[model samples]
Target: MNGLIGKKIGMTSIFDAAGRNVACTVVELGPCVVTQVKTEETDGYQALQIGFGEAKEKNTTQAQIGHFDKANTTPKKRVIEFRDFNAVEKAAGDTITVDEVFAEGDTINAIGLSKGKGFQGVVKRHGFAGVNDATHGQHNRQRAPGSIGAASYPARVFKGMRMAGRDGGRRVKVKNLKVIKVFAEKNLLLVRGAIPGHKGAYVILEK
Candidate 1:
């Protein structure tokens, strides 16, 4: 699969040729530099490791700076590798622009870390139904998971129980999304429907 590294640049609605409104996510696509190329003879597989975004000189470590030097590019904020890329001929220090890989109405997939929701309850996270009474004897069982396990059979809470703790901040992939528009000059990619993570968050666009 061919992929590009981009930033989620919020969302907006636009009118299509059919005069219908379409919701789209605006992404700042890449002019990613191919930093390293892994060949089967050497690294055991063929892959293109690319780098994107700009990082401050002092913020990145010396080792990362040196890796960017191999590509003759500036310090990048993040580095990602794409396996078995054959969409376009690429090389080390070569720039892969977003326009070459994506087109309007093309089906693509997006991967990103979801926004953190802190600690969540079972009702919100696991979709459990709480107690349903206020007048009987229950005082506050609105958002509770009543019984976890049986008394004699199990004796203790079973493993893999649907209990809520920390939620979100996990990698999520949104698939089969249609590319609404591509602004090649601006390196902007607009896609239909909602994507993972928050605005300005780093996202991987795969086709």
Candidate 2:
């Protein structure tokens, strides 16, 4: 798998050749530095570890500083390892740019953490139509989960039942999103449709 670590900038619309405004999510891809190359003989797996963004030395641990020092780069804010990265052979300290790998119109998958909505109800979280009819003595059940268990038989709620709990803040992968544009100089990529997470969230763009 060929991929890069990037950050979600925001959403914007651009005019296509058909003169229609198409929505695109803007992302700032790397300038990633190769931090380590794990070989099967050494680590029992083949993977390429890359780093992006800058991190303060004070905030970075000594082990991390030594790791980056070996790579001839400073402390990186984001470090990701791609397993079975067989697109091209790269050594530690090498840099990968956005334009060198991706282009316009390519289909890619974006993986990110979705926005966190703390505790929620079944009506909002699980899309339950809670107490829609206000008349028949249903006053406080406007957003209730409504019957959870059976009176007899198992007499217990199933384990996998969709009830109210934590919503969002999960690793979400949006697949088959087309690449709208790629600006190599600015290290920006505009992809079609909305991706997971809020602005400035880290995303993994996989092709």
- Residue-level lDDT of model 2, residues 27-88, one tens digit each, is 99998889999998999999999998899999999999999999899999999998998767
RMSD of 2: 1.7
Could you tell me the lDDT of residue 144 within candidate 1? 90
What local lDDT does model 1 show for residue 100? 87
Error of 2 at 68 (Å): 1.3
- Candidate 1, 1-207: lDDT as tens digits: 799999999999999889999899999999898999899999999998988899998999999889889888889987899999887888789999988899987999999999999999999888887886776778899889888888786688889998979999999999999998899999999999988989999999998
- Candidate 1 ranges with C-alpha deviation above 4 Å: 17-19, 133-135
TM-score of each: 0.93, 0.92
How far off is residue 95 in model 1, in Å? 0.8
The window of 10 residues in a row where model 1 has the poorest summed lDDT is 128-137
- Model 2, residue 69: what's the lDDT? 99
